[model samples]
Target: KRTSLSMGEIMTIDVFVERYKDMESILNDVLEGTGANKKSSNKEQELNSRISGLQKIVSDLEKEKEMIKRVDEARLT
Candidate 1:
């Protein structure tokens, strides 16, 4: 049971990392288009807000992944 749970957690960490990378790519694309025009400033603002939220989620997931790693290591001992 413990081994399966640990494996599941490890899988979750991989998924989270993949999602973070995707979100980061999207954020970078949005940022790159910032100077294209002035009319879509509002849209840019909305995208920025969403990107910030995703950033926070990614950060939290990373911390969770680290915590899980520590727990897994402790279990090995």
Candidate 2:
């Protein structure tokens, strides 16, 4: 199967950047409350570790977002 975005509907860099920004804010809220000192002491570190993993994923997405913007700019010619 094949699908394509018509020129009129193609997403530009702004869309990807805004998406990254939204994701960052949501992750920030989630991590702030789930960190290592917020609950049953025994599971605190474990839970924080999981949050750390999510942070890594967010970081990767940010990098990809930048790459996407660059690629789109290069295609403008």
Candidate 3:
């Protein structure tokens, strides 16, 4: 039981890190205009839209991580 719980925590942290990295990459691309030259304004808009969506996902993940931390603290206590 303890091992499974620890594994679950590790998995959650890994996923959170992955999503955070993805968000950072997307943000960098949007800010640096990387790969924007090949596409038109519409493509740029699409990229912007995707960035916005990813930002929201990242925000939610942060909230979830905080919640998990709190839960773990409560369990420890």
Candidate 1 lDDT score at position 46? 81
Q: List the residue pairs that clash in candidate 1.
A: none
Encode model 1's per-residue lDDT on 16-77: one tens digit a residue: 87887798788769766883766458777787778788888878878777787787788889
Off by over 4 Å in 1: 1-5
> Higher-TM-score candidate among 2 and 3?
3
Q: Is candidate 1 or candidate 2 better by TM-score?
A: 1
What TM-score should be assigned to candidate 3?
0.60
Task: Name the best candidate (by TM-score).
Answer: 1
TM-score against truth, every candidate: 0.74, 0.48, 0.60
| lDDT of every model, 2 decimals | 0.76, 0.57, 0.68
* Model 2 ranges off by over 4 Å: 1-40
lDDT of 3 by residue, 1-77 (tens): 33123647757866876877687686667756855465546666676777777777777776766777677778879
The candidate maximizing lDDT is 1
lDDT of 2 at 60: 71
For model 2, residues 1-77, the per-residue Cα lDDT tens digits are: 32333334335434654665676566566656665346655455655566566567657756765665566677675
The root-mean-square deviation over C-alpha atoms between each candidate and the true structure, in angstroms, is 3.0, 5.6, 4.6
The 10-residue segment of model 1 with minimum total lDDT is 1-10
Candidate 1 TM-score versus the reference:
0.74
